[model samples]
Target: MTSERFDAVIVGAGFAGIGAAIQFKRMGIDDFVILDREDDLGGTWYVNHYPGLAVDVPTTTYSYFFEPNPNWSRLFATGDEIKQYCDDVADKYDVRRHIRFGVTVEGARWDDDAKLWRVGLADGTTLSARYLVTATGFLSQPRMPEIPGITEFAGRVIHTTAWDDSYDPGGERIAVIGTGATAVQLIPELAKTAGELTVYQRTPIWVAPKLDVRISERTKRVFARMPWTQRIIRAITDNIYETMINVGVVHYRVPFFRRLNISAMDLCKINQFIQVRDKDLRRRLTPDYDIGCKRPTFSNSYFRTFTKPHVHLQSDGIDHVTADGIVNTDGTKTVIDTLVLATGFDLWEANFPAIEVIGRDGRNLGKWWRENRFQAYQGVSMPSFPNYLSLASPYAFLGLNFFNTMEYQMRLMDRLFGELRHRGATTFEVTEQANTAYLDRMTELLGDSLWTLGNCASSRSYYFNPHGEPSLLRPMSTQDAITEASTFPLSDYSFV
Candidate 1:
């Protein structure tokens, strides 16, 4: 094994890591390496190859502000296209040289006296650095349901994240478990080929119409020529999304404005009712929970896929899995040839389970989060983890577009790093008091949002922790978050 040293180390090379590396290079900072366990980049996009997987958000706004793609073939790019876009960005920015593919960071320990972090790789090689940044996204780990006899199934089984490219599901009976975002996308594609498709849903999901189309050549040419035209479109998209958040969360909770929530629910019913002809199927597909309770989905084909004659939707809870098929609570079994698990990732816990981060006072990062609850100041820095940062931090999820939120976070990081450099500080850590104060404010603010006051628990969303705390979203707008990240005093942290 080989050991190397650097000024900093970045983990995971998807949107967050790639953005971080590009920003660092722009700042004239080198001596850093981006390490990804996969041989390729595009963290989630690289791993998830499920058919019909497309960006839920518009492609115009789903990109980096620094590097805009004027030639997006579709309004919402597919999984392969997005992955290729990430690759193109990396190539254009010359970030590949600094990327160490197929290297997994197993663990990291902070050396207090030496003021360095020793990050251990899976192969027993150690790389030391002054700062450690975890860009490992939330959706890295795919989860499977804990049903009895799941392993005893005789047919081929695969998680959507680990889709087998060579195997074809055409003319075969298939069972898809879980009806989350990934399921919604892959189901429609699988329906076209599978002789029979059984969708097992524990809870209903609210789905909106996906307004997607191929980008016109004229529009692409205009964007490539003017450039400002694309920014205008992006701004309009952002405003529309912000309005949804304001109306749904900020204003909907008011006594006089509760009608907005009702209207949203009515719209959901109408959308589902129009797509599904059967009343019973519509009711089963209709979510009892209020809108915004779960992360709402958007798809043009998902709800319509149910109208297919060969498709079956089962709402009953699974009793167990048999060698032939799955048994329902009512003692009915449905035979299948292939089983697809669409259950989401273990997100409440940090994404990197293998990497045990030992921070100040021998505090393990995962252990601290589990014991004390997950709280990070500005979704970047924690109290004990000095010089360590996480991009997918709790309370950091802001705005309709994830890329926009991440851009704001990277800007804050730039400022923080600038401060560290100016002061010649070896380490920077947020204070416990600051961390608690921010979390308290977030918790109090969320009391008025739908995710907290609405019926999110019944939604079975991963947004909430085991303690029933809605730890996913911030109640404030994206602009508010950007302002906080920008103007918040750096004095809240100690420079050592």
Candidate 2:
């Protein structure tokens, strides 16, 4: 079979891929294809259909900067709404025409002499591209914990990512494992209907009130008529988030931010106390580690869910599973008819394993990262992986909101592609020296960030690599990221 060829091959049809496609189209380069494993375009939104599924961030903050939506029904949009928004974006930009749905990319290898990327598909087909962009998102994969006797359990096992619509928890004893963001949102919804709900918590999380309100149609019209109004709201929202980041995330180790962290912690304490009147339950829910150690949660009813008569919280470690129930480490067995695993995704492993990338001299990207810690120059390009760009790599995940991260990545890519066209360069790759220097500076700056100094090592956070170092979030202000991506010299990469 003749292998298909294109100027670029983008893996994923999420926000990053769509954004990249739009930017490339606007720049008059359309010889590319977007391949997604799903039948539809929305990546995470398409897969996760659990009850109470919604965006953790504000709707305005979570959206694309250029294509602002004035018709968000609520401050925090639901997963279905977000999926619709992504579909609308794909429709508006005519991106659907270039997408190959239900296509699985197994691996890709860089061809040295040809100076092109040979992408492998699951069907044993090959596609050649001058450049490869991996926009496979951070939260795409779901992980289930290794519980003994899991298969022997006759009850239905459900994961948050793979929620069964036909399975009803009403009047059934349900055991939900995990206390992260997904669990926080799901527990409240389950408590309302479940006859007996038991939540097994491995670690407690710092949860703040979700002050979400429905946006009035009149307000939406005002935004649509006068787009500047929406922009102003976005600016104010961004400033508020930045201030919180300064105190809780970016500068938590600094003396000034210590006071802010204390104040924030107090607010969380008050929220929990007010919602959970039972002292025992409240104490079980309160986190021992510092705020921002793990991914923080936001919910209006998560704490209040514990006050329900049927809701139960167990902080004891789980030993194993039996045919009828789960046994706590203390030998207490709780019989339940259904089991739900909210265990989060394996961050680095899932992100890298989704696609096997073989670089120059048969260098496997996964093995390289394991041998030498996960490091990428500017969070986009690697030293050996020439013409292969990654959207959400180490030090590239801006924790404030993912839209900002996508925008910056797409912006940098636009510039790089422009330079390639102007200079007629055959290939481009970050130099080993530049990659090392960039990582060194990032390490120095992260020395004062919360991920490094603020009790995160013991939180069971997915932010850290296997070596126990936080390698996920970029530890700088949003503006700093914008400036660096905008003004950085393109000469850092060797183009030929």
The number of the candidate with the highest TM-score is 2
Per-residue accuracy of model 1 over 1-496 as CA lDDT, tens digit each: 4378898899989999999898788767788999999999999999999888888888888899877888898988888889988999999999988998999889899989888899999888899998998888878877778999999999999998898999798999999999988898999999999999999999889888777889999999999999999999888888888877877865556865567777867877777877888888998998888877777888777888998999999998899999989998999999999999998888765463336889988998877877887778888788888898888777777746788778778788888888888998879999999999988888788878887667666888777776777676666787888888788888889998
Q: Write the per-residue lDDT of candidate 2 for residues 361-424, one digit (tens) a residue.
A: 9999888888988888778889889999988688888875899888788778778878887898
lDDT of each: 0.85, 0.87
TM-score against truth, every candidate = 0.97, 0.98
Give candidate 1's TM-score.
Answer: 0.97
What local lDDT score does residue 130 receive in model 2, on the 0 to 100 scale? 86
